[model samples]
Target: MTSVAVKARVTGRVQGVAFRTWARAEAVRHGLSGWIRNEPDGSVRALLMGPAASVADMVRRMGRGPGAASVKDVLTERTDPEPGVSGFRIVG
Candidate 1:
């Protein structure tokens, strides 16, 4: 599988809803590596790295975060994976 990376900004009821935790778990499940954080704009930003398909799947999952989260949209961009990055985490 070809490794790839993606940067995503998820908007709408994403903050204060365990979205970051959910995203971390999801990324790990897909064997992705990167970080996620809460944005000042009430959105959640994440950088995911993994197999191309897994990264894409992670982006799709961002559209439907934790049950309490009402994800309205997810803006994603293709990017280079962080060098030597391993494991997904929540960045403070």
Candidate 2:
């Protein structure tokens, strides 16, 4: 099966809510490989790569985020994976 990668930007009360940690854990649970981090503009940016269905699910979860996160917008777009990317990371 072909895997898919997507760039996701979650906005609204996302910062300071452990969003990255939550995403990293969820990605691992979903058997996904990618990364997540806090954006300077008060958003959470993430990449979810795995089966198309899994990636889609990840995006949906981003919309909901953790209970503490007030997700206002979950914007996503198809993207290419970085060379040799593996595992979910919470980057600076």
Candidate 2: worst-modelled 10 consecutive residues by lDDT: 76-85
Report the C-alpha lDDT of model 2 over 1-92, residue by residue, as the tens digit: 67998999999999998888888999999999988988899988888899999898889888899988899999998998877889999986
- Candidate 2 regions exceeding 4 Å error are none
Clashing pairs in 2: none
Residue 84 in candidate 1, Cα distance off native in Å: 3.0
- TM accuracy, model 2: 0.96
The TM-score obtained by model 1 is 0.95
lDDT agreement with native, every candidate? 0.89, 0.90
Off by over 4 Å in 1: none
By lDDT, the best candidate is 2
